[model samples]
Target: MVDTTTTTASPGSRLLGLTTLVGLAGLILFAFVLTEPDVRLHPTTGEEFGQFDAVRLLYLHVPMAVLTYAAFLTCAVASAGYLLKRRPWWDVTAHASAEVGTVFCGLVLVTGSIWGRPVWNTWWEWGDVRLMTTLVLFLLFTGYLALRRTPAEPQRQARRAAIVALVAVLDIPLINRSVEWWENRTLHQQSTLAELKIEDLTLFTLMLGLVVFGLVFAWLMLHRFRVGWLEHAQAGHEVALAIAERHAEMETLDVDAAIGRTGGAR
Candidate 1:
């Protein structure tokens, strides 16, 4: 019997899909429509300058960046588990998480660049500490993924990828703290949420965005894990089939030798 429950979508995943869709719709409504554009007078300049409409992008950008961090961290933990246990489950989970995290990290860079264009008057600045650190983090993970694709033994590949993930993950902390570590040289602003700069509906929407995107990340993880597990199962099945065929061939040789000896004795 086919395991439709796991090999395909289960009731729980269907429900999660529905919930994610609803949450995404609500996030879009609140972020794009209900929330007011960021408008504030500069303290020193006495001039009206804020992100304005562009601030809306933060609703998606901030949460994605946060989730990107979460995904990579999950990958690192799973990779550690794989190294210790040498289980296919841990390896699959680590690969899935890294794949998902890489996508999220890419989206973060894109969104940050778009948001930066109007606010910072530049799409990208090589000198900015936060930007440079984030770019490095992205590149490291990209290399990790490339290393995974390189032809090698399965165990060797997993081991190398796991080590790369562990090493690459170290960049996350620097990227996260770059703004604080180099506040003077960074173009990125400090955390507004930490400072309690937003109020009422605006804060609510931002929080809602986090919840919605978290759901998105969860959904992606579920599917990716399922796919990875399925692939692992298929490969194992193929290996087992080949071994069974080899055993059958050996048995045939033994039977032929017995028949030849009986005939010679007769």
Candidate 2:
């Protein structure tokens, strides 16, 4: 009874986790083992051109990047709800999504760097507008998380975090459009799915990766939200307990003083 929210597990979460695990395994096999390497002979130069073995990274990097966008957008929506309704559930959802989104954003950057090493001949390119924008987005949410930790009233903290999250989400559109807008300045390839550049097993594997990663995002968000809510509840319980204890101490002190006066008078 003292600890009502002890575990972050439910039957639904366990099933989703299993499904995500299976999907991940299937995606890896399709992307890395069954799918052909992206090797193509240049028509004019008669030279091999493509990501080759490095193309395998496309499945993970691209899916994570998309899910990162989804996660942040979810955060933004929840933050807006928190500001409008001043509800604890909204605030908890916003915080949970931002934390999960930041992690996914970090993975996107790392995977992009690894993928770039072979395709772009560099681990990172400062001038790449997409990369820079994504980094800024990551840092912004990270700052949002840090701001939540600063000592303040709970309502005040939640309000500020909500506002910061709403503002930080603006970078997502810029990151998405950077490749097209800054065609010359950025080294990012245009959207392959949009252009229908990928075909057959490669396309299927990429889509599978999206589904698998989406499941991953859901699983993480569900657990994190539950944990955050539980922490919030625990804090409230502790405050109430402290107040009750103080009242009990005051009552005990009053009783002791009354007894002493009566005995002395007698």
Pick the TM-score winner.
Answer: 2
Q: Estimate each model's TM-score.
A: 0.91, 0.93
Model 1 quality (TM-score) = 0.91
lDDT (Cα atoms) of all candidates against the true structure: 0.90, 0.92
Off by over 4 Å in 1: 1-7, 42-47, 250-254, 257-266
Displacement of the residue 116 alpha carbon in candidate 1, Å:
1.1
| Candidate 1 C-alpha error for residue 79, in Å | 0.9
Per-residue lDDT of candidate 2, residues 123-142 (tens digit): 99999999999999999998
